[model samples]
Target: MPRSLAGFTGAGYDKGRPLLVQALWLTVSTVILGRWWCPNSVRVAMLRAFGAQIGPGVLVRHGVRIHWPWKLSIGADSWVGEDVWILNLEPVNIGANTCISQGVLLCTGSHDRRSPTFEFDNAPITVGSSVWIAARATVLRGVTIGDDATVGATALVTRDVLPGAVVLAPPSADMTSPTN
Candidate 1:
């Protein structure tokens, strides 16, 4: 069957909150957390107010976009860097001392290719303690990074990373000048 986006309906997907609450979240997020100078305390407080389970000392930087704070749980002392987008249609659990570096995208939603209407295929993302996901990395749905694992910059992680494993981005063309 041919793919038909028009037939697509976001069925079986729970937004986890009412429309009013979502709107309010957007307003607050845009007003405060969106500002570059907004302190991490205020950000944590705001997230907590919205039912997020954010542990103490967790630093959520400015420009970090969380689709649903209620579905987010960050352990103690975790650092979410600037411009990190957590598109958590499902729950995202981040353990203690984890560092989600700048410009990273933790995406929990994807489309089912087999479905003609392209139904949603969502899953949670889990990051274990002491994990380091470097800048510009993309963690797709259903991924789990074990403790002490380091995801290199710009890497696309689509599978589970074992404990203490280091996932690096593939090398591109060499930067050295041609030999004379």
Candidate 2:
């Protein structure tokens, strides 16, 4: 069977905010916050103004891209490093003292391959307290990183991580075997 792009429709996709709001935010984030070298406090203030629930002492580094501030909530003392991308089509909750390192991609949306129309699928992401997601890591939709967990550099997280667990990479042969 031949594939068809004509059937694709984003009719049911709810972008929580309106188009005008999205446009304004995009311009502000891309032109001002993401590009310019601004202080973390300034970025936090902007996020709060747009309805994000950001706690005290949170540090958002330069070049970070947040898709929808309204759907984001970062707890106290969390650090979001440079070039971190939070593509939150759904809610993303980051608990206290978490460290999201540089180039990390926290994506809350994807496309359903099984659907003929290639429909959009979205889910929430939760990062518990003291969690550390290292540089270039990609956390997929609906994955929950438990408290005190550590995700290593360039790892791809597709499932839930248990508390205090360390994820080096995807669940594959590249991972070291557990010692008895």
The global C-alpha lDDT for each of the candidates, from Candidate 1 onward, is 0.96, 0.93
lDDT of 1 by residue, 1-180 (tens): 799999999899999999999999989998888788898889999999998999899999889999999999999999999999999999999999999999999999999999999999999999999999999999999999999999999999999999999999987667454656
The residue-by-residue lDDT of candidate 2 on 61-124, one tens digit each, is: 9999999999999999999999999999999999999999999999999987877777788899
Lowest lDDT sum, 10 consecutive residues, model 2, at: 170-179
- Model 1 off-target regions past 4 Å? 175-180
Model 1 residue 58 CA deviation in Å: 0.7
Q: Using Cα atoms with residue i matched to residue i, what is each candidate's TM-score against the true structure?
A: 0.96, 0.91
Q: Tell me the TM-score of model 1.
A: 0.96
Instruction: Give the CA lDDT, 0 to 100, for residue 134 in model 2.
Output: 98
For model 1, the local distance difference test gives 0.96
Error of 1 at 149 (Å): 0.4
Candidate with top lDDT is: 1
Best model per TM-score? 1
Q: What is the TM-score of candidate 2?
A: 0.91
